[model samples]
Target: MKKYKDFVCVGFAFALSTVSCEAKNDAKIHVSQLGYTPNSDKKAMVVPDGKVDSFYLCDAASGKICYRGKLSPKKYWDLSGEDLQWADFSSYDKSGEYYLSVGGKKSYNFTISSKAYDDLTLWAHKTFYLWRCGIDCTEEFSNFHGQSYAHKAGHPDVNVIVHPSAESAGRKAGSTVKSPGGWYDAGDYGKYTVNSAIALESMLMSAEAFPSFYKNFDMEIPESTNNTVDVLDEAMYNLEWMLTLIDTVDGCVAHKVTTKRFVPMVLPAETNVQRYMIGKSTATNYGFAAIMAKASRLYKNNPDYPDFSEKAMRYAKRAYEWAEKNPGIIFHNPDSIGTGSYTARFPEQFRFWADVELYLATKDKKYIDLTAIDTFQYDVPTWQLPASFALMSLIVGVENNMVDGDLKKKTELHFDKLANLLYDRMEKDPGRFPLFKFEWGSNGGLANAGTILLLQYKKTGDKKYLKAAQDITTYMIGRNATGYCFVTGFGQKSPMFIHDRRSTGDGIAVPVPGLLAGGPTLDAIRDCDTYVYNYDHPKSEYPTREYPARAYNDEICSYSTNEVAINWSAPFLMLLAGINENSK
Candidate 1:
């Protein structure tokens, strides 16, 4: 079997002649990428086309062999479309620069260090500060990619045109409301209730899971100097904005606060378009309820803002009542609106999550009775569908002995099944990538899957689960197809031209640091013109050679492939946090 693995040069490559070969065989080996963590499970791909059964890891400094390893065959993958093998270097635990050699071929230089993901983790958390809406990004705050007067002057959000999908007796075309202060949804400037719920909850969960790690952590945002913890302060900023979205009269939350169409690529302050409270739905209300309930618990009796918890509880109760009365209401973007729809086909999950949060916060038996855990799906968390968020919250509740006996058993059983399934899939995978499906923001799925595996490892004390989780992170920095580091401003060959409006329009040399590009998507929905090869074919048609995993282009126009999103960046941040804390 002749196996071919994808390999791209990272800036420069070492001279092949520099590595002296002891074996006389003509076969050679290849590696997926050029980096690995010292404490994580480390492995390099061995191209199956070669007859090299074994290879030696040599120290880069002295050219002395550190450890020799036999190659193990892995299952064939559709991405490579060929059988490949992996050289397990998990047993090698020394921190140094090293390379693998087979016959005359030498793999790229890789570093094994404890601080591998430290800088990236810090930058990932700071990305939220950059994404903060309705704030002036001063030079001191923004550093290199500074832009002043950025969305600082927000409107009163009165006299807005309410879409027909959201039209009610009280909310007419010329309705008056107040909504401000939330992070932009994605590459575009939009604040959505559903998306904000996921982003905020994920960060809060990160804080909960790793309290000691985040205790002294400073995001360097405007609120960093405050007496409150920086993560809580940041979440509070969005929580405040979310609170204003809910109508005090009916407890209905607007779907989004956005313009009729996406503004041109320019500085935030340059664009002066009127933003509107677009629509309201049960999904939005339920999401708002869940987030506020969670916030109520996080902010209760805190050093800063002692009254925030009571206010949040009141808002949460109001939203929950609204959801109870107006269940199953879905919001479709009105015909006139050209912004993101953010439509939720299934609002039941949102309701369940809300019930769980409210139950945990208030310890009210009524909130617990409304939950339907049997229908909940335990998978990696995402913004669009957030059953996993509720599941994770319940798991944490059980660990803290906050959940009752019945609920705790159900949560544990669900987690055990999910962990077993994930472990089995990883064990059978040829590439060892957690997610089998490659879609928009697939890297986020990879990271979230790693988070789940890490949780399982923490619970079961199984080294295999921990190793699998580490493998996923290793794949992100540099590994597998495409060979580009999905994150900007790190690694030798990372995304230079991401589909970000600020980075594209800003006159800066590089895009904002710590932004994770939506990795390869099988469906490149937007910006088809940039992919000239698919001109004659259908809009959805891509070349046969363009493997799903390899179908990525680091161009400004490839929005489907190269776009940076908050939902995608959130899990990556959590994964980095897990790795950082666990490595310690």
Candidate 2:
């Protein structure tokens, strides 16, 4: 049977080779434009229009075939209607520039090295600094990006008015509060506490998990000389902004700070509108407590901010107490408002995370009792479902024996189940990533899935988990259905037109570097009238909107598909950091 199959494949290749001359100059081959690590599993996806039973890995400078490998059996996927085969070259370990060649098509040049992703990781990390709000330090940015990337400090937000929905006896509707400084939540200029909570935790947790990787990591920010690591320093910019959302009189937290409606597509400083401190909610309060507790623990002994740990913990406890008193208060946008609504209808997930972080910070059994880990769902986390933060943190604590023995066993079991599910998904999918259903912000889901697999690899030292995570990296960089690298400013074919207001209005040819565009989604067609269905291809040959993986439109108006968000960027940064730290 094996010999017969080989004969059939050879015959197919022979018949397909005759028409290979008719192929277009641009072929349907997908590879990681950024390259791969030397010792990792490396494969490229081929569409195989005709004549491709094998592939050659040739040295880019010498034009010599370093390795030749067979293509896997043809497979079909619903994500895109393309028949695909894998070119396995895991045995090639040379460290140099190379390209893949099939019957008549050649891929873009890629590299293999121990430090393949170092520059990507650094550039992506610096995006957080560039996204900083209410700060005027474009000189530092200009120096780093090698050009003038300047914008006036926007949304100072010193005297923000309290809205009717958030009014209390202590802080009335007509009153004002000083709420300033935070990364914009998305393409819009709103600052949402609920969304910022998950974003902040992703950064702080990444720093905690890989302390040595971040030590002395110079991000070229103004705070690089502050004696603290740059990740923590960048996080502090948002942390101080979050601190202003807490109502000191009664410990209630505002849900968001935003203008009544989205401002026009202009630079941050050009939007002249009154910003309001919006509704109060149990969800936002719990989110604030969780982040503050985690921050308190991560910065406990740092020399630069001697009092931050204590002060953060104090506010955390107060916010936690307030949420405990008002457990049923959920947030909804008022009838008059039309900005982004990060509504959290159920507060239990936030409560679970806050309990875990507070327990870790204080070693209090009371907080532990409130966290019902046995009943908690171990879904891969998003801003909407955040119990994964508690699960990941608990596993870290268990490794250090900081928690009880029984709790450790339960966490191990939960994490192991999640890891196995992710591995199975990757093994089954032709794209080699766990993302199949292209919901809004599907690329963010890809990043979170990669993060979990990397963490599992770290905990168990399993090469399978590492390989799965690396495959996800390939998908994001270029090896996928759309044939476009989803990250801006880093690939041969990347998103040049992302749905970011500042990037659109900044008068720059290039969008901000390192921002991950929310990749393809069929759902965007219904939401956006300006989404183009195809790019530089006949509609019959490449139907972008019909397939989930190819549904992306790189238009500035396609917010559902092309927008960049803080929560999405956070886990993506974590995923990139993990790849650089572990792939070596």
In terms of TM-score, the best-performing candidate is 2
**What do the candidate models score in CA lDDT, each in turn?**
0.73, 0.81
lDDT of 2 by residue, 463-536 (tens): 88888888888888888888888888887899887888777887777787888999888885754553343223
lDDT of 2 at 101: 81
Instruction: Flag regions of model 1 displaced more than 4 Å.
Output: 1-34, 46-49, 61-64, 102-108, 144-171, 369-371, 530-546
TM-score of each: 0.87, 0.92
lDDT (0-100) at residue 379 of candidate 1? 71
Candidate 2 Cα misplacement greater than 4 A, ranges: 1-27, 143-145, 530-543
Q: C-alpha displacement of 570 in model 2, angstroms?
A: 0.9
Q: After superposition, how far is residue 496 of candidate 1 from its true place, in Å?
A: 1.8
Cα deviation at 211, candidate 1, in Å, is 0.6
